[model samples]
Target: MKPRRKSVPVRVGNVVIGGAAEIVVQSMTKADTRDVKATLNEIARLKDANCRIVRVAVPTREAAVAMVEIKKASPLPIIADIHYDAPLALMALEAGVDGLRLNPGNIKDPEKVKEITRRAKEREVPIRIGVNAGSLPGRPKEGAGVRPPTEEVVAAMVNAALGHIHILESLDFNLIKVSMKASDPPTMIAANRAIADQISYPLHLGVTEAGPPRTGAVKSAVGIGVLLEEGIGDTIRVSLAGDSVDEVEVAYGIVNALAEKLTGPNLIACPMCGRLEIDMLPMVAEVEKALKKIKRPINVSVMGCVVNGPGEGQHADIGIAGGKKEDEQKLAS
Candidate 1:
C-alpha cells in the first residue's frame, strides 16, 4: 500500500476518521428512521457486525426528532443523513447526532447551509458534503444537448463537493469530511482522486447504488479497494441492496483483502484440480465454519494435493494437507 494521503482528523462521536486512524468501516440503517425501535434494532446488528459508524436517513421532521432517541440507544456513532430539507439538518443537530451528512446538490441555499454549519460547528459535529452523481446540482438536460464527456462527470462531482466545502469553510467551520460517489466505479474513483488532491479533509468512500449484495460487494471492493490501496480513502461504506449488516461485512472484507486492516482469521484454500486426492470442498467448508468462531488473527490453510499443498500449508499457523489416503492427512502448526 502507498502512504496514506495527509488529512485533517475529524471526530464523529468516539470514532476518529483520517489522521493516522485505521480506515473506518461505516454502514447505513435500512429501516425507516421514524421507526425508532426498528432503527435501533438494525443499529445493534450493524454494531455486532463490527460497523465503526452508522448513518440513518432524516427525511422528515419526525425522523429528525427520532434521532435523539436512536442516538441514545445506538452502540455505534449515529450520523444523520439529510437531503433537500435544511430544517431537518437543524433538527438532527439539535437532536444531538454525532455527525451530519448534507447533500449540497439538493439543499442549494447558502444561508440555510450556513445556518446548519454554524449549529454543527457549535456542537463540534463534523459534516460530510456528500455529492452523488445522480443528484448533481444544475445538471445538463439529458435530451436538450449532446452527451457530455465522462470527464465532465468527474469534474462536476468534485466541483460540487468543493462548493459545499467552501460553504463550511466560509463559516469558519473546519470539521468536515467529503464523499463524491457514482454508481460507476471509474467515475467514483476519479472523483475521489481529484478531491483528495485538492483538499485535506477526510474522505468517505463508496460506490453509490451499487446493486445487490453479490454485484454491490464486487463493485465496492473494486472502487474502494483501489482507492484505499492508492492511499486515498479515509473511510468506506459498501452500498448493498440487502441487509445493512452485509454492507459492513463486505466493507471489512475489502479492507482485509487489501491487508490494510486485520480483524479476524485469514483463510487460505487451494482450488481443487485433477491432482487432488481428497474431497477438498467439504473439508474446506468445515474448516471455515470452525475458524469463523475463533477471533484470534491467524492464517489457516487447507490444501488438496501434495504438489503445492505441503509447501503452502506449512506456511500457515494451522494447516492441513492431503496425502495418498484419508489417514495420511498431514497437519502443520
Candidate 2:
C-alpha cells in the first residue's frame, strides 16, 4: 500500500484515529438506545469481537439520556449517531459521549450545528460529519431520471461534507472526522476519493445501508478495500444488515488484507481437487472457529493433500497437511 494520507489525529476515548495510527474498526449497536441494559450488553459483545468504537442511535430524548449510563460502562468509546434533531446531539454531548456522528444533509440549520459544535468544542469531543447519498440536501424526489447522475451524486456528497467541515473549523474546533457514504460501491469510492484529496480531517469510511452479511460484506470490501489500498481511510464501519459483530470482523478483514498492520488472525485454505485425500471443509471450519479466540495477527493454513501442501503453506505461521490416511496428518509450526 502507498503511504497513508496525512491527517490530524482525532482521539475517540483512548483510541486515536489518523495521524499514523493503525486503522480503527467501528460498529453500531442494533439494539434500541433507550434499552440501556440491552445496549450495554450489545456493546460488551462488540468489545469481545474486537470492535474499537461503538455508535448508538439517539433518535429520542430517552435514548439520549441513556448515553450517560452506556458511556459509563462501555468498554469501547461511545459515539452518538444523531440525525435531523440537533437537540438530541446536544443531549448526548451533555451526557458525556466521547464522540458524535451528525448527518449534515438532514440537520442543515447552521445556527443549530454551530450550537452543537460550540458545546462539543467545550468538551473536546470529535464530531463525524456523516454524508449519505440517500439524504443529500435538496435531493430530488424519486421519479424517472430524478436521481442525479453518478458525478452529481459524488459532488453532492463531497460538498455536503465540506460544508459541515467548514462549520466546525469556523469555531476553531479541529476535533472532526468525516464520512461520505453511498450504497453503491462506485459512487462511494468516487466521493471519498474526491473529499480525501481536499481535506486533512480523519475519514470514517463506509457503504451505507449495505444489505445482509453475504452480499454486504462483498460490497463493503469492494468500496472500503479500494480506499484502504490507496491509503485514504482512517477508520471503517462495514454496514452489514446482520449482527453488528459481523461488521467488526469484516472491517478487520479489510484492514488486514491491505495495510501492514493486522488486527486479527488470518486463515488460508486451499481448494480441494480430485487429488484431495481428506475432508478439507470440516478441518477448515474447525480451524476458523479456533482462530477467533486469538487476537494477534497469525497466519494458519489448512491443506487437503501432500501434493502441494508443504509448498503452498510454507510461509504460514502454522501449517497442517493431510496424508493418505485421516490419522496420518502432520502439523508444522
Candidate 3:
C-alpha cells in the first residue's frame, strides 16, 4: 500500500479522524430518526459490526430533537445529516450531536451557513461538507455553456465542497471533513482526486446510492478502494440500499481487503478443482460461520486437494488441508 495522504486531524466525539488515526468505518442509520428507539436499535447493530462512526438523517424538527436521546444511547459517535435546512443543523448541534454532515448545495444561504458554523465552533463540533453529484446546484448561466458530463460533475462537487469550507473558514472554524460522492465510481474517484489535490481536510469516501449488497459492495470497493490505495481517503461509508448493518460489513471488507485495517477473521479458501479428493465446500462454509464469532485477527485457510494445500495451511493461523490421505485430512497451524 502507498503512504496515506496527510490530513489535518479532527475529533468527532472520542474518535479522531485523519492525521495518524486509522481510517474510520462509518454507516448511517436506516430507521426513521424521529423514532428514537428504532434508531438506537439500528445503531446498536452497527456498533456490533464495528462501525466507529454513525450518521442519522435529520429531515424534520422532531427528528432533530430526537437526536438528544439517540446521542445519549449510541455507542459510536453520532453525526447528524442535515440537508437544505440550516435550522435543523442548529437543532442537531443543540441536541449535542458529535458531528454534522451539511450539504452545501442544498443549503446555499451564506448567512445561515455562517450561523451554523458559529454554533458548531462554539460547541467544538466538526462538520462534513458532503457534496453529491445528484444534488449539485444547477450550473450558472453566466459560466461556460458546455463541458463533458464527467468534468462538469467532478468540477461541481469540488467547487461546492470548497465553497462550504470557505464559509466555515470565514467564521474561523476549521474542524472539517469532506465527501464528494457519485453513484458512478469513475465520477466519485475523479471528484475526490481533484479535491485531495487542493485541500488538507480529511475526506470521507463513498459511492452514493450504490445499489444492493452485491453490486453496491463492488462499486464502493472500486471507488473507495482506489482512493484508499492512493492514500486519499481518511474515512469511508459503503452506501447501499439494504440494511445499514450490511453497509458496515461491506465497508470493513473493503478496508480489510486493502490491508489498511484488519477487524476480523481473514479467510483464505481454495476454489475446488478436479484434483480434490474430498468435498470441502460444506467444510469451508462451516468454518466461515464459526470464524465470524471470533473478533481477534486470525487467518484461516481451507484448501481442497493435496498439491498446494499443506504449504498453504501451514502458513495460516489455523487451516485444513483436504485429501492429505484417502480418508484423512491434515490440520495445521
The parts of candidate 2 lying over 4 Å away from their true place are: 140-148, 327-333
Task: Score candidate 2 by TM-score against the native.
Answer: 0.95
The model with the greatest TM-score is 2
Instruction: Indicate which candidate wins on lDDT.
Output: 2
The C-alpha RMSD in Å for every predicted model, in order, reads 2.6, 1.8, 3.3
- Against the true structure, candidate 3 has what lDDT? 0.88
**Please, what are the lDDT tens digits per residue for candidate 3 over residues 1-333?**
588889999999999999999889999999999899999999988887788999999999999889999999889899999998889999999999999998877999999999999999999999999998888878422337633478877888888999989999998999999999988899899999999979999999999999988999999999999999998999999999899988987887787788844667888888888888877889888987897667777778888877777787787777677774652345563
lDDT of 2 at 282: 90
The 10-residue segment with the lowest total lDDT in model 1: 140-149
> What would the TM-score be for candidate 3 when compared with the true structure?
0.92
TM-scores of the candidates are 0.92, 0.95, 0.92
Poorest lDDT segment (10 consecutive residues) of candidate 3: 139-148
